[model samples]
Target: MNRMQLAALATVATLFTACGSSSDTGPQPVAIDFKALVGTQTFSCADTAGYAIGTGTLPWIPKDFRFYVSNVRLVDAAGVEAPVTLDASVWQGYGVALLDFENGTGNCTGGTVETNKSIQGTVAPGSYVGLKFDVGVPTASNHLNVQAANPPLANSAMYWSWTTGYKFMKIDGLINRATPFTFNFHLGSTGCTLATPGDFTTASCTTLNVPSASFAAFNPTTQAVALDLALLFAATNFDTADGGGAPGCMSGATDPECAPIFPKLGLPFGTTPAGSQASFRLVTK
Candidate 1:
């Protein structure tokens, strides 16, 4: 091979290497900030500072509630949804696993006060289309043996031993009328009858599964997701003058309160009304 021909071949080889390198670089991933905004409402009598709701002092009334959301799924640009399951074994330093409301508490059996709590996670850059998750604890995990329950479950405060289940929703606050008062809006499974006298025995009770709701359209880069407590009890049936109270709704059934309040707050049901159906939207930058 002549010197000139050898040089030309070397140049061609270098150019091919550069082209291959560029092709292998692929697309860069962007950083995405994801958050879960959670809040609750209160059914209180009227006095001055609107209806008391959430964590506050000297208002109409405060109804404080917490939710434990896990096993979150994120949708990507390719129209593919990815599941982001977190370590549900603990919550905020407390030991409490995920709670399945459907199957009762027997499946896993024990938990902590912090069990089934909601937390936020970081998402990578992608065009998220929608989100999906279960609302209540599934039946398999719901009906666990309370005697063998862990810390939070062993606490007994959250458990309804008499009824052989747990309360899915605890809506409590002070109610005011011509005066001031309190209202307890606790909903869960009732009419429970045990099949056998055992630690994790099945109960004759059943829970209702409410469908999830879609709250908003979100783009992680351009928007933010937040849960507005004000919208939760906007239609609450409470009046100070008349001692008004919110209409009761069964937890596992198509309760009136669950339908009106949840949907207004951005949660909708698809087929089954047990869990919530909604995607987190980017509300702020």
Candidate 2:
């Protein structure tokens, strides 16, 4: 080839390199989506028709839905896990992001109006086919310091107290009754011991209660994480509060209500062995 023609080809290559035709520019941005559902119905504060729940199939009004997800990792085609470099926001930071499904409208009146249905971040350019994540906030910022933590961590509605720590996940609904009481599922790290009972925060919790999930064929671009409330309440009796501290499961070790609830999360509680997690499933959008 002529020298002039070779020089022209080299210039074209440089332009392509500058435009980042491949992964040389850096990682790509990814937004893993999530949604709340009771069976096939997409859950929302605007739903006036309550969903049939529990064994009786009583209509249960969606009240509140929110949870913290941590240690998010994207899985490659070869089954290798890569940690997500999360984007910082009011709902995301510090290797954790709070997924809020409620908008404080209709029956979901107690929480904030803002909703975060996706985990925004960056991932290496590759053929990622799966996802892995934990169901709670990480230990470093999860131990009773909402006052000092970052945005999503600083959200007070999620935190309970200095002794108990943050309520890792909360999914509540108004159930059938003479009064139509609310059934609250406040799952968090229990069996805690404080360093100083009166002053210091919790030193450690015997039951971390951080259940995790991994889906082998998930696609962040075309699929979303669906948290199903119907299957979660399959064994729970909304009409009766049995062997429990509250009207619903409160993550207490002795609470029989929690025993049934934990297995739905693919976790073992008391005599109830771990079952496949029924609540979280990846669905095609």
Candidate 3:
């Protein structure tokens, strides 16, 4: 071959190699924003006289209450549930770190408390089908020693020394007209027979199965998950007249209210209502 032809061939080869490298780089990763909408609703007694004591705030009923939710999940269109694990170190950047009573920790008061916090992360571009996660801490991680917790997980007030575990969910406030009218909806593993003096052990305790659920098929790229706080109280039976606070009131013994509340909170074990299911909507922007 002629010298001129050989030189041209080398140049062509170099150009093709550069083009291949550019194609291999691919597109940038897509960012996904996760949000949780939380709130409460007022319910009247069975007689319909006035709103539930704990549900309302007045001179007599000073402790008008609210429930805390954390540890949200994001599901893709393929039905794969991705648990949005919050960084236990930094509570301010994401939102307030509320105590998860389901684990047995009482109400988390310290460290910028966030009711309905929203967070964002990067995920490969794809269609997400739905999202699901626990409204309370799962049985496994709930048994941690609160006294030893640090940073985001360190809150002395929420620790329940008597129970030996954290409160999974605390729906306490006021329930009756009595002074300090209160109905401590402290829900956790009832038959907690597990006992370990040191090193914390769950070898003997019965694991309480908290309920959770998901919503209808929704596209995440264009919609955002909106957790409705109001529906959480309305749909469930909040009738304080009956055993509303009974069976489970501070008992930690697997009460009726415990069963219903978890699922409504978009938990894995609770019932998912049609309207309540819309608690979370997906959006692209």
**Against the true structure, whose TM-score is highest?**
2
Q: Which candidate do you rate higher for lDDT, 2 or 3? A: 2
- TM-score for each prediction? 0.52, 0.87, 0.54
Per-residue lDDT of model 1, residues 156-192, tens digit only:
5456556666554444444555566444444454445
List runs of model 1 lying over 4 Å from the truth: 1-60, 92-129, 151-157, 187-200, 210-225, 240-282
RMSD of each: 12.3, 5.9, 11.6
Better of 1 and 3 by TM-score: 3
Q: Give the lDDT of residue 226 in candidate 3.
A: 47
Position 53, candidate 3: lDDT: 25
Q: Summarize candidate 2's per-residue lDDT along 60-169 as a digit string, tens digits.
A: 78788999999888887789988888889999886789999999988887888899998887766554667889899776667745678778888778886744478889
Off by over 4 Å in 2: 1-22, 162-164, 196-202
lDDT of 1 at 17: 25
Q: Assess candidate 1 and give its TM-score to the true structure.
A: 0.52
